[model samples]
Target: MTIEQVWAQYRQSLKAFLHTKVASPNDVDDLLQDVLLKTHLAIENLHKPTSVKAWLFQIAHNTVIDYYRKNGIHSNAQQEITWYNEAERNIKKELAQCIKPFIQQLPEQSAYLLEVIELEGKSQKQLADEMGLSYSTLKSQVQKARKELHGVFNACCQYDIDKHGNLIEYHQQATKGKCSPNHMDCTPGVRKKSDDKYAHCSKG
Candidate 1:
């Protein structure tokens, strides 16, 4: 069946599914559009026509999660926590896997700086002392390295962040843009170090 025919057959069921997750009619409509877009872009990858229903529902599920993540609305903490445990672990893995490759793509110095500061979890002051560079110089290099890493991620995917600045979802970009990097800089605000692993940085 054609894409339009497939959509027509499942649109009502999809709408009903979305309604169960989203309370706002307008938000549901918006999310349905997002699912439609993702479906259109990815349908050609569907190998089995018989699997269309499952595939469509998967897209709907992810779109709903993206919506809640973007809105920072966790209506069900237990459900959200379960979802987060699985999803966030995958995200961190993806981020870690991409790090070395992208960092190697940077200038040698910038690359080394990032490898030590970010991957090794070294303090900036210690790095500065070891390298015999002024703290200001080390800070500048760290920032530049971070920006370059951010560009690498941006080139790969466009991330969606919530109001509280937590990463919710990431959609791969169709094309590469100039290496303009943006990092997730989180501050520790009265949170213990153990509780604030992301206090320094978060790339999602």
Candidate 2:
């Protein structure tokens, strides 16, 4: 079959597979285009036309891996800290607001841990003590929670950071309602009173 014909048959299935792995509809569209482009360019190299379905999916799978790999590099590059001006601080706060919903969507224990440690500005050691857990165990849990939280955020938006590790920009994809706050569980009382302003924050 021709490339166009093959793509027509498999595009919907590929997109469905991508949606499960990708949190953003925009990214899924972009990745589908990437798969199409690669398939078109590499089709000449395929010796077996009967294997086109497997070949197309292999390209798609690798494309997803490459997407995360590039983002992972950017994430690591943002480890360094730098001073922020007023504009940068405002942007950071805005990004923080967008993040709150994703944190709330985590498992109850993880959500609670992030809400207390992050939004409430409580120290991990203090939380460990309050929860009657050893410092090492609490630390490990916190790391896992943070990692899961990062995954949720990464799937929703693409972040841009400067050389000094400052967040400069972000692009939200077309995945609406995925990050909406569960207001019943995400009430202001769940956070410290000092953090009330950040409560009920939406992706808007």
Candidate 3:
């Protein structure tokens, strides 16, 4: 399909599909932008008009799966964040504002660990392997990092936690199963490990 036709026909469905999969509305916008940009560049390779929805969704699904593969979700929590008005956004943004100071105050190793494992979403095993550290060391680093992050949160923000002690905004999902970067990672129950037969670009 032509690039323009692809964008015109599939953008909204692609966004909705992503909205369901992605927890944050802002993140959904980011992912949709990435998908459409990639689709625009690779549209020439898509040959079937009738399959556009499936095709775009495949792209959307893979993009989000890759994010999880890299960043891991926040806390293994599945509940969605609710923001009904600008006031809510301001509150969440205010809560998130502590993030900067939290990162800056972290010791170098702790900061690096958080960036790699938390921000980048690599599995503990994957990160430990890459850093050439033993699993035990990596675990220690993660604990240290989380502890310091908590301290930063506590010191900087009154809204970081509720009286019940659960974090206010931490959200995460357990990956359904392992996926190789060399292959496609499907949704937990719906897909099994398979090669990326549909990816249009080699670099993705």
TM-scores vs. true structure, each candidate: 0.39, 0.39, 0.39
CA lDDT, every model vs. true structure: 0.57, 0.55, 0.49
For this target, which candidate reaches the highest lDDT against the unseen true structure?
A: 1
Q: Tens-digit lDDT track for model 1 on 1-204?
A: 444556667877888888889999988887775565455435545556776776677667766764564344665633642322232223222233335665777899999997776556566777888999988888888778868866765565454545532334444344322222443222111122233222212332
Predictions: Cα RMSD each: 16.2, 19.0, 18.8
Which has the better lDDT: candidate 1, or candidate 3?
A: 1
lDDT of 3 by residue, 1-204 (tens): 444445555666677767777789877876775565445334434455665565556556556765565454543212232221222112212222223334556788888887666545468878888889987888887877877866643342222224432223221113222222332221111111243222222222
For candidate 1, give the lDDT.
Answer: 0.57
- What stretches of model 1 exceed 4 Å from their correct place? 75-204
> Pairing residues by index, what is the TM-score of model 2?
0.39
Locate the minimum summed-lDDT window of 10 residues in model 2.
Answer: 183-192
The residue pairs found clashing in candidate 1 are 151-181
Could you tell me how far off, in angstroms, the CA of residue 103 lies in candidate 1 after the best superposition?
A: 23
